[model samples]
Every structure is written in C-alpha cells, then in structure tokens.
Target: MKLPETAKNRLEDALKQLNLRPTQQREHVFAVLLSERDHPTADEVYVRAKKSMPSISLATVYNCLEILVSCKLVKQVNFDREPTRYCPNLAEHAHFHCNDSHRVYDVDLPQDLLNSLKSVLPKGYEASKVELSFHGTRVDTTPSK
Candidate 1:
C-alpha cells in the first residue's frame, strides 16, 4: 500500500530525529498499522506486510515494530497474557478489549478525568505517561425469551 507523501515525509522526519535509518520494511510495517485502525499483533502485521512484501519475515516485522515504538511512531497495547498489539493512533486514549471477540478498541479519555486520576497519586509522584485498558464483554440489548 502506498502511503500519502505527507505522512511518508512525517515518518521519515521522525525517524531522522530518533537517529534511526528509515527503511522500506519499516515504512511498510507502519503503513500496515495505519491501514487498519484496528490494533494488530506482530503476527497480524507480518501477515498483512507479506501481501506487499512477499519476502518479509516475522523477525523483520518485530524489528520494524520495535523501531516504530522506540521512535514514538507507534504505541504498543498489552493485555493480560495476550499478544501485544500495536496502535498507530497518537491521540491520548485508552483501550477496551472485548472478552468475546478478543478485539481491542480505542477509548477516548477526557482531560478532566485524566487530571482527576492523577490527583490520586501520592505526593512527589509524577507520571510521564498513562496506559489504561478495560476488559469486558459487549452488552447485548436483544430481548431473550
């Protein structure tokens, strides 16, 4: 998949800032993540990347993911005992994992709520980042006999 020139330029700039060399594999991996808003695991990324890059390997996918995460171009979402998922959304938000489908969804958190959450921290404790995830089943509204 071809990435927009603007996005490609931005990602290239980010990699340069991180003193990392931008490669086609890395670009392809990021494109795959951005292609689908859904958070995907490294294995999933490998599968998608293979469509564009038939020679791509799982190790390459993992390396690309690590580089992206280190450069702050991607975020890794982890659920208890589940495969780590990668998200390209840079916006401040949390994640909701459906217990049934095993899918992850982004949940926006208000700034006020985030501030209130920080207030619970003890004195002199500062948090540079916050990661919140909720696991539950989607409620079914259908009437049952």
Candidate 2:
C-alpha cells in the first residue's frame, strides 16, 4: 500500500523530523487517517487499513497510531469511557459530540477567545494545552412531508 509521491514525502518528512522510522505500515496507517478526516478508533482504522495491507494486524495498527500521536502527527480524542479516537487536524479547536448521532465535529474558535478561556483558571496557574467540548443533540429542521 503505497501513497502518491507527494503524500509519501509528507509522511516521511514528518517521521524524519521526529527521528523515527517511516515504515510501510506506518505510512499506510497515516494514509488511512488522512484519507478520512472523521475521527476513528483503532478498530476502525484497522478495518480501513487491512483493505490494502492484508498482512497488517490490529496490534500493528495500534502501534502505528501511538507513534503518530507521540510524533504530534495526529491527535487522540477521548469522550468519557468510550474508545479513544484519532484526529489529524492539528489546528487549535474544540470538539462537538452529537449525543444523538455520536459523531464528533471540530469547532473552530478564534485564537484570542481560546486564549481567554484560560482566564477561568487561577492567577498562579499555567496551561500546556486547552481542550473544550460540547455535547448536545442536533435539531431536525427538515419540514414535515
């Protein structure tokens, strides 16, 4: 499962920057995540990946994902006790979880606003990162037939 040259270059460059090996499995897994922006769990990624890499195993998929997260090439998302999901979007944003559909959507807030949210913390506090999420149902606006 080989990615196009440009895609391959990007993935390899990122791994190189972290002084990590860009193995075929790692490249393939990253391709799978990039192909679909939707946040998917390890099992979901494994299913998508094995389509091309028939010999790939669930454990390998998990390892690839862990490496990507540690390298900051992807972000791990968690909601309550649910299985962890992965997101490739690195921008500063929040997540919206739809209670009805159980889907996660990225919510973009201005840099200033996100910075101000830290004000709610104590005066002596410091923040390494900020995470915000909202849970709600999507209202159906379709008119009755």
The lDDT per prediction is: 0.92, 0.90
| Clash list (residue pairs), candidate 2 | none
Off by over 4 Å in 1: 140-145
- Summarize candidate 2's per-residue lDDT along 1-145 as a digit string, tens digits: 5566887787788889989898989999988998876999999999999999899999999999999898887999999999999999989889999998898999998988987799889988899888899999889999999
Candidate 2 residues lying further than 4 Å off, grouped into runs, are: 1-4, 142-145
TM-score winner among the candidates?
1
Model 1 lDDT tens row, 1-145: 9877887887899899988887999899988988998999999999999998999999999999999998888999999878999999998999999999989999999999999989999999999988788999989999999
Which run of 10 residues does model 1 get worst, by summed lDDT?
A: 2-11
lDDT of 2 at 85: 94
